[model samples]
Target: MRVWAKSGVAFNGVIAVVVGLGCALFALMAGLAWPAIVATSVALAGIAWLMTIRQDIRRHFVVKHPFPDEWHEILNRSVSFYRKLDEPAKRRFERDVQIFLGEQRIYGVEGQEVPIETKLLVAASAATLSHGRPDWEWGRTRDIVVYPKAFNDEYDVADGAKIAGMVQEHGPILFSDRDLKYGYQRSADGYNVGLHELAHVVDLEDGRADGIPGDLNWMAAMPWTDRIHKDLTNKHGRHLKRLLGNYAYTNEAEFFAVSVEAFFERPKKLEQRDPELYRLLSHYFNVDPRTGRVIEPVD
Candidate 1:
């Protein structure tokens, strides 16, 4: 699997160094004074820095662009999470969808073209995940690879292929177009492949796919791990199994991903069946999925 990490800042740093050195070399060739050379080098480096971050600049402008009605229609028709958002949250979600589509690379494999609705669904999945966490970003590191159908471990698409979606550790994410379309099509099934894989991406943010997510502090992490171990050993009771299904028992990471699917897909059921688990998720995500609103801090 190919590794991926946020390279935008590193790329900008390299550009800055190159530009600064190039200016310094030219200044020396012209016998400019040392102070002038230093000043020119710093000036050029600053400009290079800004230039390298142009994608961020573009995203700032992208969010301001009028969201397309077609995209709105797709979200309205397919994404229950988006439809439940309040007006302001819906606007933020729209801006997020715009920024994500503007910044991240999502393309089909094998020259198969990705339709706008599929792309919007992918963006909507991302927006739903981070709607309450405005500070979060799906940094420009990995590409979203869309396959015509499910693939195996070898990444081959054929009969008997079982993998629907995958998020490699520090690698590109792969998804089956069929599964992605089915996921949004059945919004309340608690079996969304897109959300499941994206949750894996979130779990990997801490550089490991352990039960604890990156957003948790020591205080939260303790209980989170405790809950995972308990559930793994069937100690958290059968509600988790009934709510999440047997696939969740596969591993801690799978449990986390499945829980995320259930959390967003069947929020009320999850809250009713497993309130502690629901509360933990609510705190980490800082949103009430049932209402699509940012949860108020309980003082």
Candidate 2:
């Protein structure tokens, strides 16, 4: 993973250097004209900016939790599934884990201190699940507010009411630590609310958490919508029992999240029940958890 991370940095550095030198040469060939110098400088500046961005991204996305050595071993053991990634993907996954952790601020709400390592493990697992798609952008979720246990909150409505765990109007994701830890440890069997929520974040990449998997273009979006509609309808018809949880049927966003949990936790089942849906997810995610190549199954 270290080698892979270094390689990414090296690759970006080489590109920056090449572009910078090219601009300098272009300026010289243009007879040192003021316009040419300015253009070359701007080009060089752009390369430098990109290099800084890459470094910052790496720093933000890579996990560096200050846990005890024993805790590190425990996390490494729990996530043995991560090994299925190829070298490059593994490094990228590490980087994403770091970014997820760095972006979120976890607080102990009930005078019960939550271990940072525990939070890191949960966030890392969720981030690793989506590392394949580097293009998916979800900057709105800036933090993860965790309660030691399930807690309640008050909110205003038409009749003035209160809710718990209701994803706020525009704020961080909130999860009970108990639920998060349980989902992490046992959900390898297929129930992962963390991954489910993160999937909603990914689906929101297109600017709405409406169950539409954000695609790069209109043509891509068309096929994605068709696939989702067909799969959901087929499941509804009893032609196919839903491989994803019943919660998935709640809405588009929930469907996307629940589907993600099934994809990562029960890939073979999804493959058997809905081959087309499995294929679509595999293509979009660029990784197949069922292969056991990047992340090995837990014993």
Identify the leading candidate in terms of lDDT: 1
lDDT of 1: 0.85
What C-alpha lDDT, on a 0 to 100 scale, does residue 148 get in candidate 1? Answer: 88
What are the TM-scores, per candidate, against the unseen true structure? 0.83, 0.68
Give a tens-digit lDDT track for model 1, residues 1-299: 00111566788889899999999999999999999999999999999998878766677678778998988888999999999987977887898888888878999987789999888888888888887777676867999999988999889998999999999888888899899999999988898988998889888888788856776667869989887888799977887699899999999899999999999999998888778889989988889998887886311
Q: Best candidate per TM-score, number? A: 1
- Cα lDDT for residue 212, candidate 2: 68
The pairs that clash in candidate 1 are: 4-170
lDDT of 1 at 227: 79
lDDT scores in order? 0.85, 0.61
